[model samples]
Target: MKLLILDLDETLIHATDCYLDRDPDFEVGPYAVYKRPGLDLFLSKVRSQFHLAVWTSSTRLYAAPVVENIFPHDVDLKFVWSRERCTMRFDPEHHDYEWAKNLDKLKRRGYKLEHVLMLDDTPAKLARHYGNLVRVKPFLGNLADRELFQLSDYLPTLAETPNVRRIEKRFWRKASTSEP
Candidate 1:
């Protein structure tokens, strides 16, 4: 099965220290964590088609509890990696250090880059492997957001592609729909 690495913060859920107008689905320490709409259905539908894992830049202290609450107990993730697992790089454009999730790290663990897909909101974090990335719009506690619902329909289409990297996924939203 292909490995699908999911991002945590704005990609899947929005964790804010300040409360939004609506109550959060769950809380993580002082953060009000809101699950992206259709998150549960997305996970459920994709679980059988792909091997799932989480690769968040957040610390284990923050990521663990959030993962525990969001993912169902029956759905076993291949791994839940935290900040320590990310590669730190100095971004000259931003003039600051950023954590990047390198797919080479997965190659070291016996996974093929062609069989891996990363779902993340930040393109810069996966700049080294744009081929493997399926970018999503950042979710910010929008009650009516529907990205995940659309994503659930799009992802399975790539499940059997010989090399997922070869497919143009930057416009996956459009590719998934009949829209031009």
Candidate 2:
């Protein structure tokens, strides 16, 4: 199955600035904007073809409200994994665990690093790790760009890629052996 993991925050939704003020009635930030031109349709199309999941660094408490507000009720909420499930990495300077643990859950699921497509705005987290990541700049104010949905446009190319298939096979084999 094709798995598509999406990040929140600057990826799917754009906060006006870096910080988001909490408001129960507001779906987005005070100055935040929703780029809705084709996003809902795009998501619907992809959902028909692949298994979808939300793998954000935001805590479940914080992320749940945003996703609930952004997506329609008909959309399945099965694969919503969050920061608590992520593997934390120590940041010596900050004395905190940087949010990098999400990948570990995917790895544990036996997904080949390549069979998975991660759409994240954080280049620093994705750049050196997986081969299947499609990094996007943090959403400034636009989601209508053709480039933002490049993965959907290039699904055929992604499916036909040999290296990705090989990785998937290897991961599956490893999973089979490790199964109890």
Candidate 3:
């Protein structure tokens, strides 16, 4: 099976630090995390096709709860890694890239390097593994965004291919001319 790495904030859910105010989707006490529309369905679909895992720059203290909220008990996720698991590096050449999710580290952890794919809102985070990346649009609590659903439509194509890197998505090709 292929390994699919997922980002936390903005990729799957939107979070805010406001207390006593709840987002329309869900609330997590002092913080409010909005679940992207069609998230549950999308998760179920991908879980069947790949060995899913959550890898994020957020701390476990915050990320774990948000993950539990959306992923739920029924959704079977392979693993969850927080900021501590990330390689904290700063490239002297690029100043903005503070935290990059290095899939090279994941390779050492037993996930097949070539068979791994990552879905992340931040392109910088996937710079080291661009070949395996599906650059997801940042979901900033927008209820109208259809990226998740659009991604669901594209996933079956990836699932059909034995190696994710070998996928030449017609959806991506078609989207470049119109939408993504």
lDDT of each: 0.92, 0.60, 0.77
RMSD of each: 1.2, 9.5, 3.1
Give the least accurate 10-residue stretch of model 2, judged by summed lDDT: 169-178
Error of 3 at 121 (Å): 0.3
Model 3 TM-score (2 dp): 0.85
Error of 3 at 126 (Å): 1.7
Where model 3 places Cα greater than 4 Å from the true spot, the runs are 19-22, 91-94, 168-180
On a 0 to 1 TM-score scale, where does candidate 1 land against the true structure? 0.96
Quality of model 2 by C-alpha lDDT: 0.60
| Candidate No. with top TM-score | 1
Q: Please rank every candidate by lDDT, starting with the best.
A: 1, 3, 2
lDDT of 3 by residue, 1-180 (tens): 788888989999888775223435666666778888789988988888888889999889988888878885876777898888777677556775467787888777777777888888886776666778888878887778888887877765665566776665424535442253
Which pairs of residues collide in candidate 3? Answer: none
lDDT of 1: 0.92
Give per-residue CA lDDT, model 2, range 19-66, as digits (tens). Answer: 333322244434444543355665776776666788887778767777
